[model samples]
Target chain A: DVKVTQSSRYLVKRTGEKVFLECVQDMDHENMFWYRQDPGLGLRLIYFSYDVKMKEKGDIPEGYSVSREKKERFSLILESASTNQTSMYLCASSQGTGSYGYTFGSGTRLTVV
Target chain B: EDQVTQSPEALRLQEGESSSLNCSYTVSGLRGLFWYRQDPGKGPEFLFTLYSAGEEKEKERLKATLTKKESFLHITAPKPEDSATYLCAVRGGYSSASKIIFGSGTRLSIRP
Candidate 1:
């Protein structure tokens, strides 16, 4: 089974602080994604990377950025964290095009104060 | 707009009770419908993927059936361990992007 690992299970960040959430996946999948899970909002995609050094903006990419320097790792960056950004961040990986589905990591619960 | 919606925001069932959850979608050219189980304070675990209308997949006490406009996740004789949030998602076949739209999810609770 493919294991997607999120670097942190829980994190607290002050407002205006820079935050980095990291995710790594085995099985050499080509597609990786970052999503924020909130009550009543479901899981909204923040960003996705199809290949190394490639990235695409999803519906909720306003307050975030992403890095995909390597094939196995994808990272979500918050240039300046805010209270509204406090939510569960999920990392997922899939094969190219994702016609199948995705395998998700444990997730990082970020509380921005 | 392409979107997915799950019905019955929350449900409470007994251990031997049987029930089904609904997932309706409006995305054109659907490639796949997925069901995932999410425990509290954790990421979702992939459950089943239905590719086409009339396709059905089963694992353990759970079965999923997909139609062109909706999908149903049926849980039979569920256990306490089955209590969690069930999320449904859809993938757009027309687009090359590997992104999926997810529903808010239905929280299920099974009592002994």
Candidate 2:
């Protein structure tokens, strides 16, 4: 079974603070993704990493950035967290291009006050 | 632009009732379609993946079928535990990394 674990389940931060959400996968997947899920907007991609030190901007990557220093870990960073950045952040990983399914972390609900 | 749309924003069903959830999509090229079940305050759990038209996959009382433009997840004699938000996602062929676009999801409620 594949396991994807997030660093935090819930977090609270003041406005203009820097926030970091970490995700680790045990399956040695090559692709990792970060997304923020909202009520009506659905899960919008924030960033994704295909390999170590390789990153790409997803649809909604303006306020967010990501790091993939290693194959098993991916981190999402908020340069200056604002109240609007509060959301349920999700991390997912998949083995390869041909593999369709993804293993997801439990998610981190961040609250920016 | 690639997109995924799930219909029937919410559903209420009695135990033993049967129904189906719909997911329609438009993309330049289709790589795969995925189904997931999510409870409140939790991340999605992978359920099934449909790679092509005419493909079907099943688990327990849930069955998923795919067509050229849409996919259906049929629940047969559902139970209370089957209540959750069903999500659909599509992988576009343009990216080699298999970037996925997700739908807003359909919330299902089963009462006994």
Candidate 3:
């Protein structure tokens, strides 16, 4: 089955630490996205990439960055982890024009302390 | 601005109950509306995608219909296994058509 796989399901990081969250897709989609879901705030996009080595900032990309070195893999990086960054992070991928529904990974729940 | 709002943040129904979840949206231009089912601690599973008004799609006990301003996910004869959070999202014809906005979601609980 076509799938988006996130490297970790749960992660704990210390404040000021640099964090990396990895995502890989088997579907060879051209678009990949990173979002953080929080209580009462829903899901907020942090960044997205439409092609390898091409990344764009989403609505909430202040403390985050992304790397799409390869077509099937996208990585989300936290410059410096903070307590406010604790939330469930999701990764999704889509193909073609991206008008279709996305295939999402199970998600990574991260805690910063 | 693009925005999505889902009604009835939480709903509780007995087995065999039928109901609908609402997803209201406003965007520069509507490209697609999507419905997803998310079990606790899991990612959202794609259910349906409606491109225009009056379009409908069905799977098992779930049906999704879209209109110019909103979309609805109707559940018929729901069972306990159907209990999950339903999420609605919209893709707009904005500069970045690839960006999708998601609503807070409706948590549905079906009691057997």
On the 0 to 100 scale, the lDDT of residue B66 in model 2 is: 96
- How does each model score on TM-score? 0.96, 0.97, 0.96
Candidate 1 C-alpha lDDT tens digits along B18-92: 999999999878888899999999999999999899999999999999988999999999999999999999988
Which parts of model 1 are misplaced by more than 4 Å? none
The CA root-mean-square deviation of candidate 2, after full C-alpha superposition on the true structure, stands at 1.1
Per residue, candidate 2 scores C-alpha lDDT tens digits across B10-100 of 9999999999999999977888899999999999999999988999999999999999999999999999999999999988776676678
**Which sections of candidate 3 miss by over 4 Å?**
B94-96
Chain B alone, candidate 2, TM-score of 0.97
Order by DockQ, highest first: 1, 2, 3
Between prediction 1 and prediction 2, which has the larger lDDT? Answer: 1
Candidate 1 deviates by what RMSD?
Answer: 1.2
Q: Write the per-residue lDDT of candidate 3 for residues A66-90, one digit (tens) a residue.
A: 9999999999999999999999999
lDDT of 2 at B64: 99
In terms of DockQ, which candidate is stronger, 2 or 3? 2
Error of 3 at A80 (Å): 1.6
- Residue B41 shift from truth in candidate 1, angstroms: 0.6
